[model samples]
Target: MFVIDCPTHGSRVLLSERRIRALRNTDTGVLLALECYCGHVEKISTGRRAPARHVPE
Candidate 1:
């Protein structure tokens, strides 16, 4: 599970593994594609590194 800042929801959103569409490993962290309850898609990077900019689709 993971938590992300959802732009549409305007707060922290909880995401379960079932909500994950894709996951990619980066040199700094892991990139995750998550679907929100509102059906919004967002990409987030997580790990020991700094979080990347959120990409919404």
Candidate 2:
């Protein structure tokens, strides 16, 4: 439900449901990877971007 623009790769990385649950449980605020528009990936934080558009399946 979150989107982040990768500085290294100009792609949209979308957060998955599993990642969302994991994030909610954790407190360390780690960076997790999500699928990109081009099928690539990048890591973003809960602090970096807010959950916006729904991630495509």
Candidate 3:
């Protein structure tokens, strides 16, 4: 799961399952572009590298 902070809407949403479109590092932190099921797209910062996730087959 990841926290998405929407700049345009000035809101924060919790996304448990979603797709990450892109990832980029900037002076502030790590920027992640994500798409939600509700058709909302936004960019968010995690401050640091998100912990590695594992999935069971």
Using TM-score as the measure, the top candidate is 1
In candidate 2 the C-alpha lDDT for residue 28 amounts to 42
lDDT of 2 at 35: 59
By lDDT, the better pick of 2 and 3 is: 3
lDDT of 1 by residue, 1-57 (tens): 878778799988988999999888889898889999998898877788846565453
lDDT of 3 at 13: 62
The candidate that wins on lDDT is: 1
lDDT tens string, model 3, 1-57?
766665555666666654678888877678788886566786666665554434222
- C-alpha lDDT of all candidate models, in order: 0.82, 0.52, 0.66
The estimated TM-scores of all candidates read: 0.64, 0.35, 0.49
Clashing pairs in 1: none
Which residue runs does candidate 1 get wrong by more than 4 Å? 26-29, 47-57
When sorted by lDDT, best at the front, the candidate numbers are 1, 3, 2
What lDDT score goes with residue 56 in model 2? 44
Error of 1 at 51 (Å): 6.8
Tens digits of per-residue lDDT for model 2 on 1-57? 766675456554555554433333245455566655555555545543445445443
